[model samples]
Target chain A: MNLKAVYIHIGWFQMSVTNLIIVIGMVVLFGLALTLPFPGNSKGNKKGKGRK
Target chain B: MSIMQEKEMWTSKLRKSWQKTLPVEKLLPDTQPAYVASWIYLFGVATLASLGVIIASGIVLAFEGASWYHYSNVGHFINSMHFWSVQFFFVFMVVHLWGKFWMAAWRGRRLLTWITGAVAFVASIATAFTGYLIQTNFDSQWISYEAKDGFNSVGIGSRFNVTNFGQMILLHVAFLPIVLGVITMIHVLMVRAKGVVPPIDAFNAELGERK
Candidate 1:
């Protein structure tokens, strides 16, 4: 029942390190999902070239 | 009114309205627009899949009982599955919300879709909170003790007693899930009705403008 949680303290702001990691991971994943091109799309190049 | 026309009954009116609002063709589309290609689109389905796993594992746990789950190896595994699926569900759902927000998914009269999804997310948080309170462990005890004051400050502590294990269990397993499920179903149906909101670039292209 007395488990220790890793915490990151900066000045007055403090949060569990685990929660901080999860938030950072979500932001990174969202960035990757937005920018990374879907694979196996032969038509993408031909179709995308027409648009800006 | 023609003689052949049947009298206007509530059942027929409801059926006609349902059909008109969600035509069968739109309900089951064979293809999507060319611009539907995006990795972000997968998160919504991923969230739904995690919900399926959570429900399946939860049904097993409910059938086996909490004491059995706490002590039995198989029950422990199922419990872990239920727990992890919930984690995945929230992660995927939040990412889906992010994607929708950036794309301005409420465009083209799809405000209801956005509203329902937002409502479902709030309901899901309530459901998760109740799930935590019903864990029947020291952690749950600590959480309930801490959360009671917050609820009391909001004037709902008497009505929604987090310390009541039986009430928490019913809310987690039954009431909250029903609310979340109904809202989720409406959200998906609205998406189906409106189709995927086109990208902002597509909107600009149609208007002969650039952003």
Candidate 2:
């Protein structure tokens, strides 16, 4: 539908090293949150139950 | 009631009344990071909101038929939203990711959150690549042919067929979203569940003391 996309300037908006850094940063944060156990779990704080 | 049913009832009955279980302050307590950057962290939520729009548009396009966007008025707008939404999705996702990174937000814990998200970010790249091809226009065809050389040169030729609408659409609308969404949802829930790490003042202090 967007034949005009051919004319769109990709180089102007393409992902670059800075964006890569931001993306990697995001991933690292997500990885940390998902991999390591929560700090308060030892206190018997509410854990994931509604997820099921 | 059967024993199992009886047990369920007891859990519900024994469950503390919502009001009594948590004091109002704790229930509505401050969990947001105290020194979270004053500029809007709300942008991440906005990116997510755009993605939500994309999914809705994508579902409609799929229902109309895979190539339906080539024909209908509604389909064109839907495609436009998908196009624009993706642009915004990357924009805010980048910022959101940066915010999390600069805040040293992952310091205290949440490694799984970080890793799953990283995988999803890679998936998004794949999803975007597929989206470019699925456009079914001149740019799509040109991009498909052009990008194939890169894949072929890299020897990943067998895994991806950039020109195939069926393959690209399935990967974009089905496979990649499932992976990204599941990870993102889990990450957000965990953030809410565990709360953000407080500013690393203590860790910095320890380092300062050590120095």
Q: Best lDDT goes to which candidate? A: 1
Question: In terms of TM-score, how similar is model 1 to the real structure?
Answer: 0.89
Tell how far residue B128 is off in model 1, in angstroms.
0.5
lDDT of 1: 0.87
Per-candidate TM equals 0.89, 0.65
Q: Give the distance in Å from residue B2's predicted Cα in candidate 2 to where it truly belongs.
A: 17
Tell me how candidate 2 scores on lDDT.
0.68
CAPRI tier for the interface of model 1: acceptable
| Residues B1-211, model 2: lDDT tens digits | 5866865785655654433433353335444433343433565677679779878888887788767888988887888898778877876676667666766666667776666666767778888888888887888889999998898888786787776778888988888888878877876665554455666564667676642
Candidate 1 segments exceeding 4 Å error:
A1-3, A40-52, B2-7, B205-210
**Which 10 residues in a row give candidate 2 chain B its minimum summed lDDT?**
B31-40
Q: Write model 1 residue lDDT over B1-211, tens digit each, in one string.
A: 7533543766777888888778887799676677787899999999999999999999998888766667889988998999889988998999999999999999999999999999999999999899888778888999999999999998899899999999999989899999999999999999987788987777686788977
Highest TM-score model number: 1
Candidate 2 CAPRI grade: incorrect
